[model samples]
Target: MPYLLLIFVVLFYAGNILTGKAMNDLPPFTIAFFRLLVAFIFLLPIGIKSAWKARNTFREYKGPFLIMTLTGVTFFNTFIYGALQFTTASNVSVLETVIPVVTVVLSALIVKEKLPLIKWTGVALSFLGAVWVVMDGRLLELFSSSWNVGDVIMIGAISCWAIYSIVVKQYMHLFPAYGVLLVMTGMSVLILLPFVAVEWTIGSVPSLGEVKYWIGFLYLGVFPSVIALVFYNRAVERLGASQASVFLNFLPVVTMIGAYVWLGETIKLPEIAGAFIVIAGVILTTRAGTRKKRKSLNYKKTSYN
Candidate 1:
């Protein structure tokens, strides 16, 4: 069932790609705000009790919690919705998989995490693959083709994801996943409110009366925002983040099929090849590492002092 849950996590993540495509008319900030607000409303009942019980958790780890919530819940989706305004879902999925590479590189520089030669090689390969996809497989396009705003925006989103993942690993012990999610969801809603207000002023926010927009909004609010988090927390509990992320390699493939089916997106060979290359690099980076005893990341350490 762990394997199945991993697949479910990927599916729900793929749903985000579809959701973004479906809400093309809505302002990115508006969509992001609504998605978080709806998800926060639903998730509060499930996790708020834990958060209340652990109310001091916030006081203790205020800095980390603030940073985590801002990066993961706030800025990440902000850029994702922004990116969808200009690029294809296939490109988004393929590019987003580079999160690990971004994390690894950042860790190395920020925290001085050392990487073996093989992992370094993987990093290089993954970057090249990302460039290949961004340029539609031809390096010459780097010079000839104008860069897509969506692609550039997605890099910002991916960077936020990377930072969030690192912060989670460092401080996940402070609260249960549910409790942590509750806090983050609330923070995201609050942080996004001002932006939503601005979008409303600009008249870019879409009306909620449209059925298609409701479907897209509801799906994102529920599936990716709520369901994916539960499944991912469970997977991380069973398989450590490094092992769990291997399953994320299937993300692009799933997104490709989902994009084709839901968004009527056409896949290109270069995009496919680039995705494969990126996944291959990820596998090399993660799989080549030294082995350790099987220890689940229960992350139940008491709140920090």
Candidate 2:
């Protein structure tokens, strides 16, 4: 179930980049504001009902709410949209491949996550493969051409997602994903409102009347903002954030396909090779970790008996 959700999330997020690639007319914060506002509206009724039922639980975990608001709502998309204005979506997607590693490492540091050696090696290999594609067979060029301003900002954005996923994992069952989405979207709207206002003052507002902008706007609100998060949060619930994050390593594959279809970009051989390598690493790490976990669980049960 969660795997299916991640597939939908991958496709929706591909659209996020595709739309963001061409949303030069809108300020990043402003676009985030609109996206969250529309999402909040769409989820209001159902979300309100669910949240109402969970009011006491929501209050009990205000800390999680705040963390979710900050990480998921606060600036992830703002930073991503900001980066998209300055780099190709494909390039941005390449940069995003670092996120699963970020999530894993952060989970280790922040949550004391432990993994087998093979899984760790898989993580490292996946990163090398992503860098392989980004550097186009010249690994040395990675050091030389790695940190454009946009790519650096994107790092910050994906970091936000990493943190958000960690928090989501912590509260996977404690907080309902639906209510979390509502509250996070609502908080994000509040958070980005002033920033969007600043952009509006600076003549950086989007053309709300433009049909193309509307299409992007609606797609973002409906698909990535609302639907994707539901799927993503559920994946976090079922798989744990660190495991769910491995799925994100596949983003570039979806982005590459979407880019070709929507933006008429051509796929490259390096990207294909990198995509396969990343998938290989994801499979190795996840499968090995699961097997180890099952072994441990069986040992514990036998000892108890």
Candidate 3:
């Protein structure tokens, strides 16, 4: 289980780095549209089978399914890719480490999941750590020239993903992950079609000759979109949402390493410190939830007796 989670982290991080690199050769929307289009194509058969077996359940979950598709597949991917065009991979990576914190808060509000004080404190610390990394510790200079439009877009992307995570946990009991993911990807592709058309009309289609771009696209579609989704849903099924979320802390670390290896980007001290703080905060928050769950179980048993 731990090894699978680690693979998920590595693949997702690689996906983000590939996404960042793709931005140099292809427009963000184009990449976002096609990556999902490919995912839809690839997963269509599985979705059909799941829907065939559980048609009634599919109808019942239509709303949540649409919401997940729109937020997770369409909005999240578009914003992240777009942000990559305007920001450094490091900035995008560091900013994204806050998703776990956002996921926890959203889960509490949406599903009435009880969070402990330690988790709340951890969320705060992790958030500050992400902000520190983004600001490079100059705190007050956050909105200065140092900040780019990409940073804002990435923040929005992170929020979308956080919401997606919460919604997935809330609805997983009502629908199978394969069905949910397929529907989400299908809807995202549909939503992106018009934009893709516009870009095509403008002659913005990516060149097939660019081997690197194709490799990135293939990696994004296969590992990050499809394989990662499977692993993530499985983890969520086994561990529950809050516990599963801890895996997200490794995203920036993997991304940083990928950037250094592939893009030859330098690793700075601030990024390392920020990553550590973020990981610590995630651990604290996750453990807090574990403690709360034990207490609740105990209370239930006592009340029943």
- Index of the highest-lDDT prediction: 2
Residue 58's C-alpha lDDT in candidate 1?
Answer: 84
Candidate 2 lDDT for residue 58: 78
Prediction 3 TM-score vs. true: 0.84
lDDT of 3 at 285: 68
Q: Where is model 2 poorest over a 10-residue stretch in terms of lDDT?
A: 128-137
Instruction: List residue ranges in candidate 1 displaced over 4 A.
Output: 1-7, 126-136, 231-250, 265-279, 290-305
| lDDT per model vs. reference | 0.74, 0.81, 0.72
lDDT tens digits, residues 1-305, model 1?
A: 55578779888888887778778778899889888888888888888889888878788999988988888788888898999899877678767767766767676777575666786676667666766754568877667756699989998988787777666666766787687788788889988898889888877546689888777778888888878877766655554454455455566777777767866778789878977886776567555553322121223333331
- What RMSD does each model have against the real structure? 5.6, 2.0, 3.1
lDDT sort, best first: 2, 1, 3
Better of 1 and 2 by TM-score: 2
lDDT by residue (247-285, candidate 2, tens digit) is 776777788788788778788888779888878887887
Off by over 4 Å in 2: 296-305
Candidate achieving the largest TM-score: 2
Screening candidate 2 with a backbone cut-off below 3 angstroms (N, C-alpha, C), the clashing residue pairs are: none
User: Positional deviation of 237 in candidate 3, in angstroms?
Assistant: 4.6
